[model samples]
Target chain A: MAASMLKVAVGSRAYSSGIRDVLWKLGRLNHVAIAVPEMEKARSFYRDVLGAQVSEPVALAEHGVLTVFVELGNTKLELLEPLGPESPIRGFLQKHRDGGMHHICIEVDHLPDAIQQLRQRQIRTLSPEARIGAHGKPVIFLHPKDCGGVLVELEEA
Target chain B: MAASMLKVAVGSRAYSSGIRDVLWKLGRLNHVAIAVPEMEKARSFYRDVLGAQVSEPVALAEHGVLTVFVELGNTKLELLEPLGPESPIRGFLQKHRDGGMHHICIEVDHLPDAIQQLRQRQIRTLSPEARIGAHGKPVIFLHPKDCGGVLVELEEA
Candidate 1:
């Protein structure tokens, strides 16, 4: 939001390359991620009140979070709860006990080209490489600071 | 993620009604709202880096924010900047100076019936009535606390 107040780095040679030719194709918004301290409570709120169909929770040990997909007609909502002491969700819940929106996932057509474009533009990515996401698709996270304080996940469509 | 870890609330008499017959039909996600401090910089980032076509910033004085739409193939991103000190975006930026995701707008076929259902379920809505939003459509904001800490907007599609 404070992008104008931000110090812009001088345009790099890569960015000077034809911007039209490198335009990446963005796809549908696959899902929005929400971090909750108590997973069941969040799920119940969606299921009982909103009448959304939620999938069974699955633990991704590598990511250190339990995840569930609340299916809606257009897109899905991913609910996350810390699975281990060092889980990042634990840190987030420590600040916001009630939980909060964590990230938004947007699908892209080509993962490799997208990553290459981001790298050339010098955007900060959370992982050096794309990891297999909950959807079993290649996904990479961009740093929140780099993304106007909103963590963004780009999933291969 | 931990849908299984939740304790199910026992059904109340209010829930015994044939509410299932009146299920609200949710449509495609209309847009996701982001609160940014500087509109131009945020626009440039999306336009140049993400290759998104952002619309001209439009001031919504009644809403106390300047809004712009970043057109994606599947969904749109609404960027908001506070218009004055009294603006809610100013308050959100007080806590998160860098700006952040403000809310998500989902479309519903029937907003009045949806609001009635939410009222029946005792869900907290930001306004007692629906207001005309940026798209010139009736929209209502649901309280974040009642929505698992994620501010939600239901727009009549």
Candidate 2:
């Protein structure tokens, strides 16, 4: 019985250690934001067709855009459209030639600390300072050219 | 004084409602997985260069691939490489032309119920049945064609 117990203990230890290593590598997923020409049409596909729950639309006057949030399993899909001329979404649509993935936002525990770390490493940031996001959270954009063409957003949740 | 008091009460209500809406949109992020050609090269960029914490590589023999998890701010970046001849990542790499975003995984409260809901809606899934994922959690994959060319994974944690 003792020998059998020892064997079980060793097997369990091996499994747990492997899992721990994987967990160490994983962080949390932020929000996936998609740029669209029309917010209502995008919502129809994401909400009606895909069965994602829609949150009330928010209009950010300062940013010159309107956004609708779709609550997925455990993440939020943000659909953004330009409110008028000179909106960022308008520029994105013109550059990409179609509505697609715009950027990936990642939540950080500390906004200042994260920004400092990135700055120290000579990473280029799109915004010099954090700005108020759609949800009123402080957020900053990282230049895609520096991150292998992947636009990244660091947010304080 | 009575009129002023009434105005303050109404203002407070509006403020509270706005705050509630923002909090509701801030959901828990699960993980973002990226398809790469070589796991070692991905690790060098994400881990050594980006200073992201990493986990030991794990080989999923059945899936014909190896995966390494990298911890970012509040989310994990999963790097995948094809292992055997039957691996799907190889095809994904070829189609994409370079390592880019692969699939976004969202955590759900229930796996069976979500799968049933998707099935009833005539949505096609990669796997007919849910399988255990890296963390011993049930996970199912949704076909990209059904979701507008975006492959999604629903994980029960």
- Give the best candidate by lDDT: 1
Model 1 lDDT per residue over A2-64, tens place: 212222222221111114355467777888889988888887777766666666678998889
Candidate 2: where is the Cα deviation over 4 Å? Answer: A1-30, A36-38, A41-53, A61-64, A72-75, A85-87, A90-100, A109-113, A127-130, B1-29, B44-52, B72-75, B95-98, B109-113, B127-138
> DockQ (C-alpha) of model 2?
0.12
> Which candidate should be chosen as best, given TM-score against the real structure?
1
lDDT string, candidate 2, B65-146, tens digits: 7987766545566778888999888887786554667777777666787677667656788988999876678888888656
**Candidate 2 lDDT tens digits, A37-135:** 767666655554444456556788798888877665455677778887878878877864446667777776677766776676567788889999876
Look at candidate 2 and give me any clashing residue pairs: A25-B71, A27-B75, A27-B76, A28-B74, A28-B75
Candidate 1 chain A: 10-residue stretch with minimal lDDT: A9-18
lDDT of 2 at A56: 53
| Clash count of each predicted structure | 7, 5
Cα lDDT of model 1 by residue, B87-136, tens digit: 87898988988888899898888999889988877788999899999888
| lDDT of every predicted structure (CA atoms) | 0.78, 0.64
